[model samples]
Target: MKTQSKKAMMIGTLALMLGTALAACGSNGNNGSSADNGAANIQSANGAKGADGAAGPNGGTAAGTDATASPDLSKHVKLTWAALGDPPKDFDAVKARLNEMTNKDLNADVDFVWIGWGDLDSKYPLMLMSGQNVDMIYTAGWLDYSGNAKKGAFTELTKDMLDRYAPNAEQKLPPEAWSNATVDGKIIAVPRNFLEYQDAGLAARGDIMEKAGLTTLSNLDDVETYLAAAKEADPKVVPFNTGASVGDYPLTSFVTRKKALVSVPGLPANMLQFDPLETKPQLTSSFDDPDLLAAYPKIRDMFLKGYINKNVLNNKTPSRDAFKAGQSALAAYGDNQFRDAYNDINAAHPDWRVSFQSFSPEGPFIKLAYDSGMMAIPSASENKERALLFMDKFFSDPNYYMLMIYGIEGKHWAYTADKSQIEVPAGSDPSLYPKWQYPWGFGDWVGFNKPSTTDYPDYAKHVEYMRSAAKDNPYANFKPNIDSIKNEIAALNNVFLKYGGALAYGAVDPDDALKKAAAELKAAGYDKVKAGIQKQLDAFTPGS
Candidate 1:
């Protein structure tokens, strides 16, 4: 695919600026003094100096040396890694510290490029099309990892290459993780080892639940009872605050064994639902599904009965903000969001405790593929070997990993009294020096240490619960080739954008909305896409 001229011009300008910065900082120098000396200093401090005078973590070889010596590509090469979100105010200081360790240990410098979430969809394609100088990039299934891999936007990381350059990553990550990262038998990216369960559920204000005499939220009926009690406690407070953009399908579909049909992210209007127990999976519409249709009217009745916010269809404010302000009693969220939501709500209302209950607490937990968050090498990289070395070090070395995730130890955060947990300093202003960390893109969850500030104290236990309970998606490995129906997918997506949210929110009559959506989908050639998907599914051999 050819790049747009405008994007090419922008990339050229960025490359020029980066080149100038590298030259001014003298980061390209080949002298091995800093790296060699730093390694020696660490060895002396740890008293791990070997008989050959080489120093390293395990006392095997010097910092950069191993059983297989790393290639001498340390000519001060600066690699750029792109990730989503804005850089912190003190990003430069953090980058400098990162360079200090990397330059010394791996003879490399890395520049992080932060792309705002809104701009990523547009920017990523441009960067790939232009063959931008970025060596490493953060990608995910949500970001169209499969599409990009198929389009040759990322380098295919062979097993031998990984063994040579990133052996730590290969060995530490689970075999299932590698399988998730593989596309057409080629590993296109390194999956971040952090595990998270994304089952959808409700978070309610504990104070409200207690005042209402509600003990636990086990099922939809229990949730309704809690919401009703919350309404009785505070007549002004909305029992449940929902928005047009947020889907209530998950909240209602919890009891059903059949999954709700929804558009796949990045692929847009192509929709599918699978029965986990079914040997031969088939795509079907939620609108036509009896269970989904039955659930919608009940939610709509709740909205009409003042149990849900009156302005839910038009409310633009996020549910978290509404809950924090005491405007809402309960909000729908994923299992992973509970801890963060609890912390945020408590920060605003210290007296108000927040509790989350998973809608799907039993077996059949949906296991997300490791490619949910990953770091991929761009095919345009000039320093692939050096990039791999840096990644290996980032995951293997605890000190380097910590620095990369959290900023300078004493500055951004400090250890608790016993040095068992991380915390902010007593008098430091957190606003001035924001702690910016991207755990998803960084490999090696084994190296990750959670800060004590997280509201869920039993996070490890929760992870274990999910591990033993959750079941993998039967069609996780299936990747449908949508090249033939691209235009139809786009058209169907446009139709969905116009009608899907309204149906999800129960903002319109279910029968009317469903008929309209179904008709439009058919007019947009949904059958062709369905046929295409079916063909791929038929050809797929389970566990092949």
Candidate 2:
């Protein structure tokens, strides 16, 4: 979630490094701050109707119209939204508090539908394709946002709609956020304005480390040492309890340690690689990386030594949950996930010490793609205006935003005395009312975002380090139009799963599986896909 006060701080920090981002076209030839020109330009570009035309969805005035008049809040309406993850025990309380504001402001109430992590892959598309009653749903780059948008699953957002409904967000969000969310020249979702470093790492029990006399984990070898020690100390405990769905320790290690390769956006299974340092954007098959090949043996060794679970391919439980339940000694995931693990574990077992270590502590940090998290409305939604209006509160009102993110303050979490930081409240059981996994469409910077309070010291330190170390990714806004190579991408993805999955999981020797996988990928049209992506990359200008 993004907070209003933090905008200046983030902007100031980004100003020193992130130079001017690529502004969205039709942005009045500048940043998208001037609503007047932006709306008119969008009207021309989208061919939206003017004021005299039929009303837009939810009985709202047509786009490109004079929207100075306030919306009619006389009629009470109910909206249904779908967000990621399981709902907390105090969800009713949080929703009730949120509706109080919406009821008074927009005369609307909302029902939040929670979609668990496992269901997201199948359910997101089903909800859209089935024409469900969901007014809004959480979407992201990894969730096939462009694919869904192309399928007419989402509404095309115009600047007039934002200006009239979500004025605060329309004014505050940087141009890059909108530019990145644009698919085929239509803004499909509202991109979160928060700056995030989506780097990978592992969390370990600090208490165990102290007892074993182990040093801080700085690299892969250190992690292996800690895992081995933990395994020796307790043979029953799975040292690394991770699964195939999210990510693996091997890829995270190579990425941060080597600092040369990055996962291509929208291409999972490490099918394609991008080098941000390249003067011209480049994409190559991950199978060709020599460093990755060298690392496979190390991962295989860990698998053979019983440090990682042999049934990792079938493991469905999130690593964080396993870590908290005392099922594992090492929890491997992105750096951002450590906060939840720390919060839950500290709440349950006060004596336990949890800490996170980046595989590479310095260098090679790229900020997250702006569209990594977003709020999107389905084409079936009849309350489109109301949904936008509700989302607007997240940006316009800090209290509403805070309540949505942190829950009922004292009951769920509390701010420190100085109000500069957040911390768990006394006697609160974090597991009973977990932090909302989906921050929705906002990040703290745009006044739409996430906020968390942890008793763990390393939590705050990690955030500061990421903020200081973050670098601009030149291709952050470049979204490859995979529509042309959909068949090829699908085929290559299957090859990665059948062959690359085994190699990545350390189940097979790279010597045998790697060549077979490369051969299969070529037969599946890997070259055509790579060339198509490269062509798109060549046409992209970072700050155009």
Candidate 3:
């Protein structure tokens, strides 16, 4: 039996202090379909689902879970991986292919365990506490990955282990990604390295924009312009689509400093100087802060004016569909979602011209914090080395990786003549599409599809635009020892859940919301959380 890791312990302690309160407040599955786990699904609502694996690549070469000097990796071992979102449609079929690889190379096999979206946060922790022999876990810093790492829920994979077993994974990821995975200078989890260009923008209905006498959607201010344009052009349509409680999952991917008001409540209490590198810092309430106070009426203004969907508060529409079917004229989401939405629209309405705008023209338009792509090894696994090895293959094995993420050839996805753009088969149910959760793929170095995107000149143009607007995050390495402010985070977030949307959409009275938000922040121990974080930052020098 493998012993509990320090990371798990810390996570447990913090969760004990924090998670319960959060659960009480509403971490309720914000998923539209009682099944959506807040995980960002960038692909269209239902383009082509990612295909299943056919006797795939990488694992067939290794044999066994031997961390010994001689490394006897030939023994067939069963390892378990747990994650919250849906897997590829070909998960079972792909599992067999991966098993075949393990049989060939490492002489090992894997057991796939899935946790439904609703049960993930609560159930995953209980499973870990029960001492289940899980080998690897998928984690994003924002999604409790680093918190669990700090709690000793995962083992540190030393350079020695990487050199010995998973060299491909080590080599494929860039230093930036690997560096982010380090806690106390030890690598505890794997950053799913998929290519990413951080840019938060808005997706506009090309047809609507044309009808509205508009050339393009560019800024937050332009939101009203587009809304008016869409409204004047068509009488029975909502100009924009937004949800009251929806977490900005996809938008966070492109923006630079997306601290959640719920995820990190203190956005209103006092201005906590957040570090760009260390994304795991426990945020304090900004509810009382002047800047945050300003955001309240801003959001309310939009809500009152009908710039957004009237039913936004109770909206359950799959984001892109609302825009595609002409229910809404725009979607203020992430660049990836925007791009993928464009693809979906093209597949369905091949005749329409579509495009989106970057985070507003007036700064504060975006910030990218923790990525959607993150995975961690479990502290309870007996075959961690082997688990990491398989993961390394998953990361480095492009053939298998693409097949797992994008789907099969000529069936679910078809390549353009130049093999640049991929198109999903017509009328494929969006639900059938795989969730791509085997391991979250962030825009890491591992997935550069030069051939896959050759024909999509627009995608290239978008990448360039994103590149120009993208800012290198400065605090990617800062991990707030939230051990001290654990309880306060949940409380603060509860208060935030009450006010976050009012400000974002100009729905609530700014002064009144600030009063309630500030009062609650103090009650929730905002000062203590800030001081804890500040002291840590003050004492440490960056890169020391």
Ranking by TM-score: 2, 1, 3
lDDT of all predictions, in order shown?
Answer: 0.56, 0.60, 0.48
Q: Write the per-residue lDDT of candidate 2 for residues 1-544, one digit (tens) a residue.
A: 0111221112111111111110100000001111111011111111123244422222344456777869767778889988665677778898898888888888999888875543443565789999898898877655557777888999988867876887666655656677778889998887666544544456678777876677577655676788888898889987887653333333335442446444455554236766776788577654776766776788788878988787665555656567778888876545444445466666576666777665566656556566766789899998998998888777667777677666788987787788765566888777655544445445334323334545346544555565566667777666667777888887776665465445555666768877787788789998898888888878888755
Global lDDT of model 3: 0.48
Q: Model 2's lDDT to the true fold?
A: 0.60
- Per-residue alpha-carbon lDDT of model 3 for 1-544, expressed as tens digits? 0012222112221111111111111111111100011112121111111123111111222345343355667677887877553465556665676677667766787777776432443467676667789887655443555656666777887766765666556555555556667776778776644323333445666666676667755434455666787778776876666442222212221222333222322221122435334444344333433444444454557667776655543343534546667676665444344443455566666655666554433333112332324566677889887877777676556555555555554445566677645556566533344323233432222242322331222644555444444445445455657766777866765555455434444445667767776777789887777677767665655543
> In model 3, which regions exceed 4 Å deviation?
1-79, 83-134, 172-177, 192-196, 229-238, 243-292, 305-317, 324-326, 350-352, 361-372, 410-444, 454-457, 468-471, 505-508
Query: Best TM-score goes to which candidate?
Result: 2
Higher-ranked by TM-score: 1 or 3: 1
Clashes of each: 0, 13, 79
Residue 517 in model 2: lDDT: 72
lDDT of 1 by residue, 283-388 (tens): 6655555766776776666666687765554454545446667777876554444543455456667776777665555535455555666788898988887888
Query: Candidate 1, 336: how far from true, in Å?
Result: 3.8
The root-mean-square deviation over C-alpha atoms between each candidate and the true structure, in angstroms, is 11.6, 10.2, 10.4
TM-score of 3: 0.69
